[model samples]
Target: MSYILEILPSLLEGAQLTLKIFLWTVVGSIPLGLIVGLGLTSHFVPLKAILKFYVWLMRGTPLLLQLIFVFYGLPLIGSGALTLQRYDAALFAFILNYTAYFAEIFRGGLQSIDHGQYESAKVLRLSYLQTVRKVITPQVLKIVLPSIGNEVINLVKDSSLVYVIGLGDLLRAGNVATSRDVTLVPLILVGVIYLLMTAVLTFILRKLEQHYSYWK
Candidate 1:
């Protein structure tokens, strides 16, 4: 117990960074994804083509590779215009990668709405923005919430990938402690912490789903 207590602070610090990354990624990705999702459904050919290609590239590649590219690959080019700090790189990769996924989910949600709803909104003289906000968004939210919850949970685990960029995330902290003390205790604690985070998030997401279930 003494040894565990001694190592707890470092592990907690790492967990804090992990949480930061996860939260920021969720915040940054969702709105951007909504925009991308709208673009995917737009009738404009060029815009749709670009967004589709962007989504494909992001979803097709491993997020680890994206992290490497953002952190390591970009700096190799002669100009420093694209350089990012370790933490920034990790957040950028995570948000961008997850945005692609969320975009697809949102696109599907948006597409699933009945076409007559749009016509009804038009007959009501509702602007496109008003219609989307007042009528379409609630239904889309209920449709996408489950999918978003899955991604958010995945984000918790994926935050560990920041260690590859030398960000000292939860997994790295545990690894450091284990290597230094030659005990698995810190690693076990790290796993427990991750499980706890996911469990809490699960509870919150369930509540959100229940609240939105009225749309059904």
Candidate 2:
């Protein structure tokens, strides 16, 4: 236990960076995804085609490759126009990757809504914006919440991928401790930390699901 106490602060420090990446990705990706998903549903064929292509590229590629590209590839082609700090590069890549996924999820949720819902909103003379805001979005949120929660938990684990860029994170911290002490305890602790985080997220999401159970 004393050994755990000794390494706890360092692990938490790394966890903080991991948490930062997860949160920023969630914050940035959700809205960007919504916009892209709306574009996917737009009547404009060209716009939908372009957004679809973007989503395909984001979703088709590996996120680790995307991170490497953001950090290393863009600079090669950027001609001094696209330099990003390490944190910025990671943030940009994570947002780009997650946005594609969320866009598809949101698109699915949007498609699930019966056309009658829109017709009903139209009968009430709601504007397009009003219909989305007051009717469609609320329903979509409930439908997509579980998927979004899953992605959020994934983000927490995926944050460790930043280690590929040599950015310190919980797993990397464990690696450092293990290398130094030649013990497996720190690695086990890291796994526990991951489990604890996912458990908390699961509990919170379950509560959210219950709150939305009114639909049933």
Q: Could you tell me which residue pairs clash in candidate 1?
A: none
How close is every model to the real structure, measured as TM-score? 0.98, 0.96
> Considering every candidate listed, which one attains the maximal lDDT?
1
Q: Model 2 clash tally?
A: 0
Q: Residue 22 error for model 1, in Å? A: 0.3
Residue-by-residue lDDT tens digits, candidate 2, 1-216? 999999999999998898889889999999888778878888899999999999999888899999999998898897868988889999999999999999999999999999999999999999999999899988988999999998989989988999988799999999999999999999999999989888988999999989999975
For candidate 1, which ten residues in a row score worst on lDDT? 73-82
Clashing pairs in 2: none
> What is the per-residue lDDT of model 1 for residues 82-103, given as tens digits with 9 covering 90 to 100?
8999999899999999999999
lDDT against the true structure, each candidate: 0.94, 0.91
Give model 1's TM-score versus the native structure. Answer: 0.98
